[model samples]
Target: MRWPLTDAARVVAEARVRQGWSRVRAAWFPILQAAVAGSIAFAVGHSLLGHPYPFFAPVSAWIALGFTSDRPLRRVAELSVGVALGVGLGDLVVHVIGTGWWQVAVVLFASAVIARFIDRGAMLTTQAGVQAIVIVGLPALGASGGPLGRWTDALVGGAVALAVAVLTPSDPRRRTRAMARVGVEELAGVLRTLARGLAAGRPSDVEDALVRGRASQPTFDEWLDTATGARDLARVSPAARRHRDELTALVQAAVLSDRAMRNARVLTRRALPLLDPGPTEHDLHAVGATVVDIAAATDDLADSLATGRTPDRARARLVAAAQRLDPFVLAPDDWQVQSLVLLQRSLVVDLLEIAGVSPRDAREVLPPI
Candidate 1:
């Protein structure tokens, strides 16, 4: 029992380490940007503004920039406004009312209400209240450059963050493409797992495929979000505008692939019951082989999307697989098998659309059941 528990612990630890590494890979660039922006902010506040401790300078810069390339210039401006408003109000309130429990409560309420009135953004209101509380809690001793010195430091930070955001060179499509590849690869894996399960008539394999598909939802969601962010960046950045059409196609692919993944999960779930009563005389090997073909097509589609290449090969393979999804011919007399085929047909249609096929063309590729 101890050995088993130790093994389980080791597996969990390794999985967590992998997740952490993946996050680091995805966020390293944004992290570097934030760090640079903060250092610059602190330098400007401390050197030019003559603030000895200019602590809020780096704080405001880091908060405004954050650790994601998805942030647009407008978002950075909004965050900066939030930080400045919070620090200014906090300093004013602390100077007037002095630091105390009641002062803290009063400043928080006033700052939050004022922030809400100024902007509808939640970050603005929350930051305002939080900064006001910080001001009231900290000692006012050793403060230089007057009561508004900290506020000035925050302004310097905000300005530095805005400058950094505008000057930074970024390819908006890169992250979106990476996320799309991850999503489509996971979808392919699910299909391949489902294929093996169906070919072997193993209910456990089908269950495993279903579990993997469900777990992949977050990846699909992230893909969609990254695509949306790319679109937003294209709207704002001149350099990214040229790729708007490509970004739009990627967004569509993300949506279609998410649907494909959902349909695959449903198909996997439905397949489990058919195989649950132990292996029957009905040979599912051919059906499984068809699923493997679809998985291969999905892999090709992922490669095309990731590399900015034409998906002609993927489309061709998907069209061939689509032609084979005829329930009436494939499953014949077995209604249960026929139902699974129909679900697979839907999944194939989604993949076809992701590969740049029109809805009508994608549907027309499938033989009527």
Candidate 2:
């Protein structure tokens, strides 16, 4: 067996290659922003302020920017405040006790605990700990040998970040669309896997699909959070005003998709036992085909969400596929079988609702008993 570190490296490397560079592609814009933010912070702190070196400015900006898809202003402000708090605390402690191994431990612990006492945000708590370490590890006097200059630099960096956020904001709609796409694709993937497992009557395949479905919950939650942030940004940021409607739709989509994923997980769990060896090759060809079609429709709708296109045909196809799953005819004998059909139909309705259909209309698409 490989060493644990090597195994971890291998897993990370493999993940890099998975998903067709989608993850890497999504990072380019943020990477560019970070580089630019760093440059801007350094320029303002050093050239403008005549500081020989203003390291913390750029560092603060980078830490604040983070990798969040939305909430730039809030993130930058919270991180800046946390950094200031930590630096102030560290400076006070160092002034009294001087810097040493024991001093470093005390400052870090105090700074972190105080930050937690002040706020519960992850960014705030992290920045506090990190800034305390920076203060204890490095000299208190910032470039130009000025006392407490690090705090000023941090303020400058945070101000620049906030300015950039308001002036040249990242497109929250695009990020929301990306999040929604990931969530919808996850659902489609699970459904497609379920279809394949059912068609082959493989209990193992069904079990694997169930695992996949359960694993997709985090993606759904992330989509909801990202969409919520986007909606909030769109509401507040004047630059994002035009995207308000789209962001709102994405927020609604996040909710609908979450419910659909829940139903999908339930369906996958139920399908596993039905496909056990005792069933002796139950013919699920037609139902499987319909499920696969629903998956295709889901993918189509997901792509449309990303592109802001009308998925009229896909929605119609989804409605038709859902309508075909007549539980009375398909799973009359077993309640377990009937439950799966109902759950699949419910999933389709949720997707339809996410596609802009009214709730009542979305449910009406299902076949009559």
Candidate with best TM-score = 1
Q: Write the per-residue lDDT of candidate 2 for residues 62-144, one digit (tens) a residue.
A: 77776554646776778877877776666677678878999888988888788888877777878887787777777655434
RMSD of candidate 1 to the truth, in angstroms, is 4.0
Clashing pairs in 1: none
Instruction: Give the clash count for model 2.
Output: 0
Which numbered prediction scores highest in lDDT against the true structure? 1
Looking at candidate 1, what is the lDDT of residue 147? Answer: 93
TM-score of 2: 0.77
Whole-model lDDT per candidate? 0.83, 0.76
Q: What TM-score would candidate 1 get against the native? A: 0.85
Off by over 4 Å in 1: 1-22, 44-50, 105-122, 142-146, 232-242, 277-279
Q: Which stretches of candidate 2 lie over 4 Å from their true place?
A: 1-24, 43-53, 69-144, 279-281, 331-336
